[model samples]
Target: MIRKNYNSLLITHILDGNFTYVKNGKHTTAHKGDTVILDCYNPHEYYTENGFESIWIHVSGSNSYELFEEIEKSNGTLIKCKDIHYVEKLLFRIYDSIKGDTPPSELRISVDIYKLFAELLNFQTTKSLGENNYEDTVQQIKEYISDHLSENLTVNELAMAAHMSASHFSRIFKQQTGFSPYDYVLIFRLNRAKFLLKNTDLSVSTVAYKTGFNSESNFIYFFTENVGISPGKFRKLKF
Candidate 1:
């Protein structure tokens, strides 16, 4: 266990077991394959639990904090790695660069580190937003749909909200989320329908209308096509 403050951000990769952070009467756990961030301004207690091991890297320079600050403002948290293989490859690359012992200035290691951080931010944002690009727009769309799934949705209107051309939005949305805009809207409606069916006593026709389906037949057709069962059958199974 170690702690220090520098002009740059530090990243620690937990290779085995777990680590804990204690501050302000709260404990946060980072298990194996997890990564943690050490900010330059925050002082906190950290320790390994259950025989933990980790690799750490310190990055310091004039612009080091600047990059981290930008990432923090955009994404908030720095500890994210669900896959161990990805973390291992990143750590190996950083170690190899440090061990190469080439001219430090010639290596431009800080720039590489910033790029890695950017990639991590993008990955986390994409995973959370359900799309790789236009994350802010995607998040907005999700919120709007969640709040107003009963209202009719059009690709033109959604693209306008995203501030992009309809065709362009459609293409990029499918590329990022693996679903066309229409299909995603349908999926949202279907999911909400299931929730209402299971939890509420609304008639099938009412549920279909509230979920933006034009008719009970259309709702049943799509529900059966996508869910492999009619909404009535689904409700019965739940009951």
Candidate 2:
């Protein structure tokens, strides 16, 4: 089949036979147990000489575009699921949900779509680590970040913990986790700050310091920019 410039995302799982997928002048062959994710906003074609069988879905709305872009950036548009059965299960759940007499809830469909994305991401992470022999390095780096949240963290320091150069570590970290090292650190700090603000009576300044920000003003600025509210305001909400 041929398609282009459509405003939705397409995910297809190849259950039988084979097909050639061409996107942006690149050709890929997908066979049984493989999945193809396409941003229909681009010109693409996929067809089989002998025909093929597959389960497919089109997804749009909410954070679908952003999530698909992130996954494609890290893992490409095609993947061979390590657990194709689980992938099929998720697809079936979505299909069944929409086919029921009572219309499915938005949350239910979103959950399944998110799970499919997670499965794709996890597969990519495992594939990257296994192929590159970074078996324990990424996990170690994440643990180090968590353990040292109360202190300043840098790409250089994180690379040292992973025993790789800054550039190389940064590349692998983004590929494996779909986020740069700096963004990862920032997100981790924000999460910790939120937790402390909500769970403890610590002052905003103390929470800021504990999460590795240099000053309360800087932390407040960062939090407000990302979370859309001040730390004190976030804490006041009944979460």
Candidate 3:
């Protein structure tokens, strides 16, 4: 049994066996390939029936506390890693770098730690999106969007393609792609208009229709607002 309260974060990846972790008096079981993240300031405890093999690291200073809080809010204290081998490799790299004869600077170690946290956050996001096939699903949706670039798309239509509710699809889409579906559609249409303007002899009005805008005026307004120039002026530029 181990318990403590401090201003650091502890992340442990379980490689073998099982253990029970307690946070705020709630007991959770962690098995192989599971990871336990603890904000040391939150009194917690963990113990194994027999014995378990694990790799862990303690991080503090800088934005470590803020990062931990964000991750905890998204994934809670106990997380199931998508790839335990990758997590182990990262932890081992940090360990070896520090234990070697020529130890790296603190910045190098901090960067690796940040990368580890990123991977954890990614896993959490992917898990929330769906099972392991979520990436394939999102890719398929993107392809559908591309293939229908000349049509006015709606959240209901896109959600039907994704087999999810509009609100759920919108939430996960932004989490995965950093843009809402409407914003993504708008950006895609803008890029297609730019391509037609730059690479083809299509007129501005033709480009507007081909890219799904309702009128030449709307397309010009949007293009000028986002690209900082009118489409005609944009096409006239040589470099």
Candidate 4:
């Protein structure tokens, strides 16, 4: 059985015990360290077996559909352990932030959640294709991207990070990800922009600049093309 929460999507990191979920007429089971994606708009039910414990994040907003679509596109699903370590770390970070008595800001929390989801997507994509030395390469590339989202990222730089020639790295990356390196970067930037639009008071131009767009027009074009809405309209719809 599947239970639906119409107002919020649930990300549950099951620390222990058994879990099951059904989608598209199929059922899947998960053990400890697994994560589940419960789509609020979809009717579904799930339950824990013995010694069930998990951390759940409830996500809702006008941009929620966009987030869901991204996850779905990358084959994210319920009762999977893809990127469990990253999700587990994020859960702890969220807990720490709350327990540390820092004033809660919606934007900060939302950004963290988005990053967790993005990492999960990347993990799933990389895992399915079974690239050589995938784990280390992906981690290195992820760190490089995070550190330099404010700067221009080119295939040559990414190849250097992976210690491969530009052409070889591009081919291998596409083989592993089904997306070119640059396309992945653009998608990542767009995801960040979505978080900012929904969670921050920053102007669209400022958000674009902060997310590494060369200009507002470039940001708007890419965001609108990928996200199905202009940045200003997206912000207005969500905020």
Candidate 5:
């Protein structure tokens, strides 16, 4: 069907059958387990030869444009998800929140949308780098960040640890690891939070405190934004 421009990010997850998604003067077929992340600012259309089922979420936020740009640059708008099962769960959770009696707060929605964007980027990074190579400097940077996720980390500080200027270090780091220092730090902290949530019976507050968030609320917010669910919900669903 012809879809008018949306002032938001539009995501479509195909569960069954296939749909043709057109954008930017090009079109692609999205099959079962395929995901299409498109900027609604552009005119787009979806057509199906047969009836199809899909989950769609429209998101708008400060980070939406950047995430959309990143995805477009690296993997274009279509994401053949590496983990469809996990993606399905996230989509269902978003769907539930939208369809619930008490609609979820905007914070909740933004977080879920960011989480989905992160997943797409992570998958693209993984796919673009099929081989594994970790240098000592890269490993050391990761270790330091992981060890001090509870502390405020700055580019200068991380660059100092690597014995390089901030700009130079950032350039090489992104080239080597497929993530900027800032993005890497966030991913590391989020991963650590996930581990703690899965392994410990700690309260959300405690997890937040341990994961470097100044307050429980902040931690929960960041976690929800990155993981697409509250810390409690992630713990329950994952564990």
Candidate 6:
């Protein structure tokens, strides 16, 4: 396959042989049962010395590029899938949703996309850790950020906590976590709010304050923007 100036995110689950190609001047190959994620924007082509079969889905959305860029930064275009059968099921579900009797609902489709990406992110390479062992360093950074989500945690503060310069901290952080410091804080807050909403009877306003949002409206706005539902509605999902 060859395409230039393509604009969708492609996730391919290989079935036979290997996918060999040159992407951005880097030649790589994906063996059978491995998943390959390629950003379509760059010029590339793929073929195998032997025949190959695969299931692929092209995705385009608001955050596709940002997520793909993170994956690329971590390791080129391919990542391992822990359970190839699970991936096959997911791909089949996506296919059935698109072609089955009832058209797939927007919520259902979005959920499928989320699950697929989550699987991909789980298996990406931690290349930013570089030559030395930084497991403890990264763990410290996570703990500090998790412990102080209410405070305005910036890259500088996080770097200080990890005893590294901001530039180096950010590079490693992004590789290890798939999120910038700010994004990680935002996600942490949102997830905390989700936990509160699902497990407690606190009003949305109180939850907002507890999660570091300045106002209930702002919290609701951010929650709805990322979660595709209101806090009230999401709470009902769990209950």
lDDT per prediction? Answer: 0.70, 0.83, 0.79, 0.71, 0.76, 0.76
The C-alpha stretches of model 6 lying farther than 4 A from their native spots are 124-239
For residue 143, what is the lDDT in candidate 1? 64
Which candidate leads in TM-score? 2
After superposition on all C-alphas, the RMSD of every candidate to the true structure, in Å, is 12.9, 16.9, 18.9, 16.9, 18.5, 17.6
Superposed model 1: Cα runs more than 4 Å off: 1-133
Clashing pairs in 4: 1-45, 2-44, 2-45, 3-44, 3-45
What does the lDDT read for residue 135 in candidate 1? 59
* C-alpha positional error of residue 36 in candidate 1 after TM-score superposition, expressed in Å: 16
Candidate 6, residues 181-213, lDDT tens digits: the string is 778778778866776786679999998987788
State the lDDT at 149 in candidate 1: 72
- Candidate 2 per-residue C-alpha lDDT over 1-239 given as tens digits, one digit per residue, 9 for 90 to 100: 57888989999999899777767644455778889898888898765545689999999975888888888877677776789999999998898888889989889999999999988866866554466466357756876887788798999999998989999999989986668999988977886677678768999999998899999999999999998999999999873
User: Residue-wise lDDT of candidate 4 within 102-198, one digit each (tens)?
Assistant: 6876677777877877765665544544543664585468557766877899989999999999998888788755679998788667756666676
Residues 1-239, model 5: lDDT tens digits: 45666688888899999776656534355778889888787788665545689998888876788878988886667786789988888888888988999968767866777788888877856543422223447656866876777788888999999898999889878986678999877766676677667667988888777667789888888888876889888888721
Worst 10 residues of 4 by lDDT: 123-132
Superposition error at 23 for model 2 (Å): 0.4
Instruction: Determine which window of 10 residues in candidate 1 has minimal summed lDDT.
Output: 20-29
Return the number of clashes found in candidate 5.
3
Query: How well does model 3 score by local distance difference test?
Result: 0.79
lDDT of 1 by residue, 1-239 (tens): 33445455677777888766643323345667667665745556664424588887877666766666766666543355546577677666777777876744435565567656766555564474444357557656766766677788999988888889999999877864568999888876876687678767999999999899889999999889988888899888822
Clashes (backbone N, CA, C under 3 Å), per candidate, total 0, 0, 0, 5, 3, 0
lDDT of 2: 0.83
Which of candidates 3 and 5 reaches a greater TM-score? 3
